[model samples]
Target: MRLPLLLAAVGTAAIASIAPLSANPEVELAAEDMLAPYYAKLERELDLPVAPAGAGLAEDTVLTRIGVGSCNHQSRSQHMWAKIAAADPQLFLFIGDNNYGDNGWEGDAALGSLRAAYAKQAETPELATFRKAVPMMAAWDDHDYGFNDAGASFTPRRWSETLFETFWGSTEEVRSRPGIYDSRIVGEEGRRTQIILLDTRFFRSDLEAMPYSETRPPLGPYVPSTDPDKTMLGEQQWKWLEAELAKPANFRIVASSIQVLTDAHDYEAWENLPLERAKLYRLLAGREESGLVLLSGDRHAGGIYTDTPDETGGEQLWELTSSSLNLAFNNTASNTAREPDPKRLTDFISEENFGLVDIDWAGRTFTMTLRGNQGEERVSRTVSW
Candidate 1:
């Protein structure tokens, strides 16, 4: 079901030195009350008992169906999780904005806010059920990273990263690392699928905000930075990504929390770092035979984008953007202010939606589908490699 707009407002207050409760007691109690019926329904529907924490499908398991989406508010009703679970995707990718804990406070208050958001998500019956059914992988965006449109300068990033790892069950090795960027290969030899999760927030340079103008609406106040020194993935992560790309895999999915191929928009996207965008295009173009596809979330709308021969030197690149698992951007007229993309495979969907990618390994084909709350496919496209 669609939820009310729950975007976290940016706060400027500093955190107090005293430790606070991990979660607001009143909110926690209310959430439990609200989730009682849903949990009861879930218990009735699924005969199997809840699996132990971190119990999920194996890492090298072959995936036939994959679910993707972002921009979830922790307090909202996540009925969409049940719908996504029904789709039976072998893997679920939470690309970013997994929660809306946008508290600007540092120290204990910030930590407590982050903990509270994750606590709500963990306690949600639909999500808890979904986690038992499918394995999940996630990355962070601005809101969940403790601020709105945050970057390297966001001081509380280290704390947010630690909280993210704790909630998501990331390994100690990963937690000890610099950023959350990681890569994994699933399936065996001929049918392997490589999933690269990028950390866009950890080391990203500040975006160039455009001057106030009535013309900008959906695109926001960000302009493409011409500074050659600006970087998105940072030096170490860039090197790691290049190495990961060089590895063998039948198909590869590069997951980013922001749109990479849509440069016409003024919104926060890879376009804001033009040179980095070009580097990514070139990287994929160089590895054209690897069967590359981009999956991104952040825009609060769902759509598919493509880069043709001219853009990628004869290698066509496709990107599917699914966003707003609970909160959707329903105002379509306002989105018209952004420049139109000719490569868009379908019109932008402003309803609460999730993305599905179905791969037919033997047939070398895949279908990308966007589904609404009622479990109806709003848009779909099938392509063969």
Candidate 2:
């Protein structure tokens, strides 16, 4: 199987250098003899400072600027943090692929890799300063969740959840759940904004791979799974989402680790489970009273998509996706898996990028922008509610 370039780069070096406590005699003996002190040092360095309490933004505070991005390789330079900080967002949302742990090995090796990745991220001066300056929330995609394109079947999911909670300091209510899906209401009363972080990886069923055909052009290896029984969020999360939508919030931002609006992309996305996508649309349609916007990551390239009013109950539903804070698919020629989305408002940007959402309460308008590492705006769309 072809590995992601980042995974390939880390490859054996990670195994040799960061193997955790293992039962395999060779690994175990090596850990005890040579890696123990290294692990100890990493543990000390990984100690992230505690963020001030509360649900990030104050309920009474006006919601304005927000920063979002994903697919950051832990070992790589996170030069975007400075630009992201410069954007002056009140909150930062890390949608997924937060770290390229790619811990497929069994037992303690997975734990060790996760620790090492988190340690690298925590040690980054820019990242540490950003964390101190901005209140942040996160959701994990495949890499940080312990495997590539992993889902409910990933055996180490619970262990991954444990690590994620500890490193991110997730709330007790979120930690109590089998999955990391959580929702928080920020802002207050008439200006309240609900941020629903979806756990797409935990309950998602296995995706269907496309069949090879001699007559058809190979779009990619995946096709929509027509299985009505399959789900992206499990039944419990679905119920919780319904309840969240019913809450009286002026606007709601649903954070998915993968693109929800771009169905033509033949990658890991909501398109793989058409029924679930339909369900999400239906949910939004049913709750037109609550203004809804989608946020996502995972795709290295970033763009903004808007569904027609007909599809969203006379209101255009917008999805802003930002990805690869430190990594980008510069070779666009080789990445032709995505079909052009009619709803796309901006050119897809394949560079080290992040997204900014600026809400104007006085004008009752919002502008979303995809910006490069240096804070240069690549594309932006301003729309009124």
Candidate 3:
């Protein structure tokens, strides 16, 4: 069921700072009363937006467009979502790290933080408007999952997993599944398009820490080992993905919070799990899927990366990654496309913008545009693949 448009609720922690009880008891009490009911209701109705199986497009497919992005600091620019809504996308994919909730803790404090963090975003006027208009789905990153650069072994992992499912509005059936990863279909013109939403953070291995002596950036330009065991998509999800992809579909959109293709982002990405990245690339290359596109968010910028087939009969896949709908860090370095790095597999790159993906099945073409808050088109491209 669709929820009513909600006013931005203050994060419990932020509320303490914004409206300390000692300073304003009356206002604080009123806010608490209003927020308590909604919070309680959501906890109970965690499994609300479950679309039935076999539920998808039939003949006469509709033009579907999706807007994707990540690393949004909801507290910074929560009211600026209109720029995204103006594009009129039917779906919004929140890749991960949606809320900067610390993952180091669990229990009442951690869950409360996650709820408050999401509450801050949920109450934003920009997101609220879009939610009222379009459907939204999300996955988790380190922050929302409990720790910065954490993995499946984290203590809060299971609880964080349940919270992610509930907050994103999954169905009871889906919640019963072993993992949060699932697929949905939207069909048109006798062609069915499957959107595969994968859960990367749910079962990731811990990212190695950097050496303190290194004077370089805290994140990296470091190379990851190509060990066959080092993985981004864990074993279960990886196996599930193959089966899901093998199913007949006209198109597939894989959503991940981390960068799928290696890039110059000094942040975390699939590159950190090099072997897994190669495995995914090889899988897509060998797969016979008609139209395969990758959707990712997390870099705080939007970019389109396509692979042209080589002499081998292997197929090529295209990736479109957008980040930070409201908050973007200005890349001091040139933001233009750079030559593909030989060391790392990153093909193209752009930083500091959000993305709008328009799919016109009837026209047999897809268009994606990356825009800044001022509505400037930072990057725009279309592909017939």
Candidate 4:
């Protein structure tokens, strides 16, 4: 029998902040009333993971075009893949929640379900075709990482890491690291582009939820962590990130599985770990000459955001957040389905979509675009440092 997503997500303290009230009958009843169609859609998902498409992306490659997306439930339609493929990006970043492997299950069994989840995604014809055509990089978020909003306390994380390597390939530097964080410097010196994908779950501390009254959707369950002892990337990853930021590159795309610049939202983001968020800003601020662009996923919605923190001066720190390649919950009708973000520079997308970035190496400018299901640029921005 298929399990419900919310039930297993809150099965442990590791994910308590995501939905601590899952045991409440009223909450369950409300869920059923509001999202029955979403549940029905998940029930139809089958276990059918395809074989690995073989590793791609050479170290020497100079990528000017890249695609990004996350929060794809394998059981749903991947209609956006075709559009993303049509855009002809050289590399694609499948940032997080690549599949709902542990969505309705928990414990060791939840981690075990990842095998089939990876299989289901691989067998998807549209996704298969896209991967075969486009060289890709990936990272994991809550659901695909074994539980929703889970972190270091999760026991099955080590096992999940092994499975991730098996399907995504353990050839890169990530294979040697404890967490999934990775970096690549492509192109020659003058045109170097650095791609860094971070692992947000492995060593992250448990999140503290706000009072139950403020824990509802649209309100968000988490508040900025006041405990300075709490960590998001841990000490080792922090050292690694600092080293990566210092590397020579004309442009850098820092990929986080969660949002880094949005402090207004109470969801799972860097803002939830205030100290760590500030640390990241300082690291990037120390090196303002390197063109910086942030890529993030995990939110069901997608949008463009920018911030000019005091650490980084007046220059804008651009962040493009794209998500839910399939399972879109952004509804204009439901006030509870969405919330406001002061840093957002464009309208958020709740439907199937992907983000594409274009860099003009000679001109020293880049364009960030959110492409819709029909291959149209729904939102776009171009700027130079």
Give the TM-score of each candidate.
Answer: 0.83, 0.82, 0.75, 0.83
lDDT of 2 by residue, 1-385 (tens): 2223323565422533232222233433433334344444544665532323324556576678888899999777878989999999998898899988774444443466666787677667778788878888888898888877877766445657867887788989998887898888888667777788999987787788767777664445678888887889999999988888888887778899998877666788888987888788878787637666789998898888987544455657889989889888663334433446677766778888999888877787888899987899988988787
Candidate 3: pairs in clash: 8-123, 57-187, 61-188, 61-189, 103-146, 103-147, 301-352
- Among residues 3 or more apart in sequence or in different chains, the pairs in candidate 2 whose N, CA or C atoms overlap within 3 Å are 59-187
Scored by lDDT, the top model is 4
**lDDT, each prediction:** 0.76, 0.76, 0.61, 0.77
Ranking by TM-score: 4, 1, 2, 3
What's model 1's overall lDDT? 0.76
RMSD of each: 10.7, 8.1, 10.9, 9.0
lDDT of 1 at 55: 42
Compared with the true structure, model 4 gives a TM-score of 0.83
Model 2 scores worst on lDDT over the 10 consecutive residues at: 16-25
lDDT accuracy of residue 385 in candidate 1: 80
In model 1, state the lDDT of residue 125: 76
Cα lDDT tens digits, model 4, 1-385, are 1225543554332332223234333443443343334333433653334445843877677778999999888898878888888999999999999989885563432344677788777778887788788888888898888777888765456556766776777556687778888888898767888999988998888888877673365657888877888899989999999988888888999999999888767789998988888888888887635777999988777888998887665667999988778888755234223566678877777666789989988888999998877888878999895
